[model samples]
Target: MQIEGSVAFVTGANRGLGRAFVQALQSRGATKVYAGVRNPDRLTLSGVVPMRFDLTEPASIAAAAQHCRDVTLLINNAALGKVNVGALDTAFIDLSREMFETNFYGTVRSCQAFAPAIVGNRPSAIMNVLSDATWFARPMVSAYSATKSAAWSYTNALRVELRETDTQVVGLHVGFIDTDMARDIDAVKSSPDFVAHVALDGLARGDEEVLADEQSRLVKRTLSTEDGYYLDPPPLV
Candidate 1:
């Protein structure tokens, strides 16, 4: 789990939290950092090597695995979200499916493709970027919340499955982050640099789950309470 001398492959590394991950890994002394992006031309980071791939494309996922055979840290950070304005509208269903395609199934695909390379590599780790949405619901982002919930479940299962191999499976959950993904949201957002720092710190310490911000930590603490936080919708401002 030590970042020093490790090889890391991070998806969605062109921007946002993914970019932060690439920078943090390099700063922590990773020997090689493979930055995965749909368009390799977009990657401007100096130290990281860019690899072209899309989460929704099976071939791309397979190719990345084949190409980054030495990667010991697999970070699944790519995600998409489309607003679902109305539950009764067909567009809502379509949006939900789209979100799941990237957030849920894409994560599974990445894990499946990279697990073999990381299994026998002692001190290796897999980090899945999840969200506070996994534990709470909001009308404006219902579809996103659902997809994150599914991903959270998958991360838990993957952790247990990879237990024998000693490959650390870390789930990173946070509320809104100060990234393009939350550009329009007015709520307080954590800086991507700070979030990435906490996530990498958790990985080094072999923590199973990292709640990156106050909101995420709050939501996690309420998960086991009777009539949990999810029971009531937050009042709209």
Candidate 2:
């Protein structure tokens, strides 16, 4: 669907990749952009409406969907990546559960809550900000990868379910983004603005899946190889 004049709603719009998404939408001529954040007061972007939204809270998501009924585009950019995800030891269960709540479950909640509005507004779309980790596993981020894997699969299913409607479903895969989420990670990273623009471009082009960076592209290309990148993947950097 065309982004110009589209009404878009983005979750976790307070900062990082979510902030980039909001900016890109504005530059692309979106008529109205809703920034979904737990604390609307923290939003600094002007001319954009802010709504209280917390992925872990079903009530907040439902309320945002009800209030932002004009939203023709839904961008699931909110996620929990850093906290407790780098370890899978004694506290693995707790850490993994928390990440899943905000990553997988939260995204699913956003999709479910906003489907009615998106469908009613035909010519709409849903873009889920996914990760390259969906296809590989790393010890430090195994739990995190698991969450993204679940989300990635769900995105595919969602696309199939929405095939008959005018609403499009797209999944964006990328390596570490140069955002606060990867503030300390010592690895090559894609610029948030760059990835955000690529994602919007893919959405406009009606692509069901978009690889935002070379690392992601390479990783996907090796998925079917004899060694299979997942078995012992090369360094993304």
Candidate 3:
């Protein structure tokens, strides 16, 4: 899908990678961009329409889908990640459930709600923002990782289901990014602008999956190796 003259709707567009997506889409000549957010007041970006979209709320999702019927590119970029120290503890379980609510089920809801519009348009696309956590687990972020894994599986399934349609389903995975979500993590983080550029480029080229950084590419390569990264949970260092 060419970004030029396309109408896009991006969730969590107020900040982070979502914001980068909005900017990139505009820069690439998207005719219109809908910035989906829980609170429309928070959207300060110009040249994009702000819509009230809360992924956890069915009504909000439905409303946004109804309002943005012209959208050809659906960017499911909103997600939740809360770190928990103990993977087996009740706190971890609760947080994991919350993460899944946003990362997994939310993506599903958005796809279902927007399918009609996307399918109505030819050569449309859905870009799901995933993570390296989908392929590996860290003790501190086990819950978040599990949610991403579920999302990855869902993205795969959705891709196969939509194979006959004009809509393309694409999954994007990357390691830590230079965003508020990784503010406390002291590590090499990819620039959100660069990741967004790679993602859109992949979509235009009809790539099914895009690894936005070296870490993500490395992790994907190791998935088939003996004693792969997913086999053992890594320490939180």
Off by over 4 Å in 2: 83-88, 234-237
lDDT of 3 by residue, 1-237 (tens): 899999999999999999999999999999999999999986799999999999899899999999899999999999997788766767987888888899999999999999999989868999899999899888788899899999999999999989789779999999999999999888789998999999999999999999999888888988899977778745545
Error of 1 at 88 (Å): 3.9
Worst 10 residues of 1 by lDDT: 81-90
- Model 2, residue pairs in steric clash: none
TM-score of each: 0.96, 0.96, 0.97
The C-alpha lDDT values of all candidates are: 0.90, 0.91, 0.92
**In each prediction, how many residue pairs overlap at the backbone (N, C-alpha, C within less than 3 A)?**
0, 0, 0
Best by TM-score: 3
lDDT of 2 at 210: 96
In model 3, what lDDT does residue 216 have? 89
Better of 2 and 3 by lDDT: 3
lDDT by residue (tens digit), candidate 2, 14-45:
89899999999999999999999999987898
- Model 3 CA lDDT for position 139: 79
Kindly state the number of residue pairs that clash in model 1: 0
The C-alpha RMSD of each candidate to the native structure, in angstroms, is 1.2, 1.6, 1.1
Ranking of predictions according to TM-score: 3, 1, 2
